[model samples]
Target: MSPPETDIAVRLSGVHLQFGKTRLRFDCAIGKGQIVAITGASGSGKSTLLNVIAGFETPDAGKVEILGDDVGGRDPAERPVSVIFQEHNLFAHLDVATNIGLGIDPALKLGVKEKAKIASALLRVGLDGFGKRLPPTLSGGERQRVALARALVRRKPILLLDEPFAALDPGLRAGMANLLLDLHRQEGHTILIVTHHPDDVRLLADSVLFLDGGHTLLHEPTAQFLDHSDISAVARFLGR
Candidate 1:
């Protein structure tokens, strides 16, 4: 029983990217509403693959499709995706609500409806009354909550998280992971998160995409990836 094309949230076929000495080639299809963890050695192009899908980096070749549409020609802003980075990427001076409002409208001309949406998003991320606080005043976890809130407001069908919880303490990271899982269940957004933590993958990802030497070494269900660390490369990477 083959799934329909519409069931694929993201597809990268024969995708290729190059930067100086580093060359990347990727091919994978992630199902709709699934959470996929992208893991690899530091320079294995994990983030770059996300960039290519988000339209931040143009691939040298191949198709980049989102929800059955070829979005390779679209700009980052035009893509049906929201990206959350490790830095949180919040404005130092902007209040939390305004930072999220920017996601709805870059000009920040947030209307009544937009304001309500922001409020709802804040609540969804467990930061309801903290909207007036500045980014610097919030703890690292709180700041990442703001980022997640912002992504929620965008209402994109796809979410790209580039090690967004990497800097958080283990407790905070686990909290964020649970929050993310809750949000995903509610929103049904297809998520691709780049992370180095096996626990993160174990906790959240339905599948794992393992990159090595600028190529996809493996892409399999989380159970297979975690249970069978017998594969030499994955074993070495997982330190099993």
Candidate 2:
């Protein structure tokens, strides 16, 4: 059964993208406040799907609705979404607080209230007193936390992540996943994660979207996707 529009946080319908001979299509509805993982082999278009939803890549044909509003033709910044990437995308010249403040206003004209929000975000990401540090001085994991803090300050309804934890070590990755889970519980932002790690899928996602050859092969509950699915491709991928 289709969920009511209000209950859906994101919907991609009849989405199509083509590059050379490769063609891609996606159709899925993500429930409100759900964390869904996009998983696939290399060149399977997992990141491309995230790009489409983030408005970084335009679909040749499709409708992208966020929180029940059609966002087709909208520019990236105009959309109510925040994106965090694997590299963290922090500016080398900016301090952590200034870097995070950019999420609220790119011009950096931050008032007291905005500065308080930055402090709160830093504390939420567990870097309260480190906001004055430069990105280069921070460890990889700490930098990623700064990226997450930046995302939190953006206060968007939807958060898109493209391998944001891929560069971290296993322990750090797990910690980040737990932090993300806690943030989701507190903020309730619908999250879509494009990840290559099955452990990530197991730890963070409520549902899984499996892609192959640029097409959505399955969108199922996390348990079904991991344990009881009969899909041969998934079995092969998981080495079951």
Candidate 3:
């Protein structure tokens, strides 16, 4: 069952993140249950935007709100968000179940309900019956599946993924994108992903957010962005 369509799930109002000579600014609203794909050149503040939303970095100015509540001051652990990095972020010492369990409780204190949720999440990610494996024992794609499972189990209102399947081969990377589509259909969480994969964006994103030189050049529905050539950023990114 999908969550009810309400107000914006994520809103950044004149937000700014400043490094030595670079400043990333955004003023936008992502509707509830929308999947927005973010793409840009490597240092275009794509990941930094997600980091700011995830509370890893506080913006230099403006409000960051999620689920209609201002959350600029929230800690990473306190925000209504979950994140999956390009790195699977699995602990080498922890087994799959234990690593996933951290989502339920960082202390790994699992009761029956939490264990059940972990199993369900693993099943959702297509990693059923593989809970005993450690990170090193899993393939690159399988490791990403574990990360997805962890994010899903958190049941946060928003989820962010940074180059989620970058390490996988082409076929495997596509498969992970399909899995994400299916999971989003089932869970209905608002999702923002930073990736350079055109196929992933073409196949899954509801909207395309194009960023360049610290500014968002366009935010449009995927089809319009791809079909309309008026946006030079999209054309340049597509090598057209």
Candidate 4:
């Protein structure tokens, strides 16, 4: 049977954010299970937008919804959202198994069923036997897989990735992108990734969101956006 239609995963209506005197407003809707890439210059507020969705930053004025629930005033954990950042954010003192297991609950007590679930998550990310190793001992790619595994364990339908692969080499980056695509397909998670690389968008994004100076200037399918002359100009500006 075909998969069920995705309810809207994220929606922002008349969203406005202010940092002191400067303000940014934009409207956007991200479909469920779609991989949307947010791209722009350094100060374009791509990260800010993701933060707003993840409830890390509240918009000054607007409605924010995730999975059809009004999440405007919800805490980050209260929203059905997961975020992976550039820093990896793994606990240096914990073993990989403990780290991934913490995704389910940071309290660290798990029943047999929960332990099995954590093991399955590790296997899904190709880290089955590496669970006992420390995060400091793993390669960059391996560490990232652990991070992805954490997101998987959270079982949230909405995911926000903030330059999660920015520090990897070209080959590793490609691998991580492919891994993300695989996870998105398997889990049917709605994802919004903050990135500056056009090639990354081309490889993994179903839709593109271009932000310029804190405003969303373009939002369309990846192919359609790439074909637009104005978007191409912006892509050129980013050296894509």
Regions of model 4 farther than 4 Å from truth: 1-6, 231-233, 237-240
- Any runs in candidate 3 off by more than 4 Å, and if so which? 1-6
lDDT of 2 by residue, 188-219 (tens): 99999999888898899999999988899989
TM-score of each: 0.97, 0.97, 0.95, 0.94
What would the per-residue lDDT of candidate 1 be over residues 40-122, giving only the tens digit for each residue?
88999999999999998999999998988999789999999999999989999999999999999999998899999999999
Residue lDDT tens for model 4, 1-240: 112335567888899998876688878888888899998888888989999998999888989977777887889989898899999899999998889888898898978887888789899888889888999999999999999999998999888999999999999999999888888789998899999888888898988888887898888898887776656647574465
Query: Least accurate stretch of 10 residues (summed lDDT) in model 4?
Result: 1-10
Model 2, global lDDT: 0.92
lDDT of each: 0.92, 0.92, 0.88, 0.86
- Report residue 238 deviation for candidate 2 (angstroms): 1.8
**Could you list the CA RMSD of all candidates, in the order they appear?**
1.3, 1.1, 2.8, 3.0
How well is each residue in 1-240 modelled by candidate 3, as lDDT tens digits? 223436589888899888899989977778888899998778888998899899998898999988878887789999989999999799998899999999989998899999999999999889999899999999999999999999988889799999988889999998999999999999898999998877788998999888888877778888887785676767767767
Candidate 4 to native Cα RMSD, angstroms: 3.0
Separately for all candidates shown, the number of backbone clashes (residues 3 or more apart, or on different chains) is: 0, 0, 0, 0
Q: Which scores higher on lDDT, 3 or 4? A: 3
What's the CA error at residue 144 for candidate 1, in Å? Answer: 0.2
Candidate closer to the true structure by lDDT (higher is better), 1 or 3: 1
Worst 10 residues of 1 by lDDT: 1-10
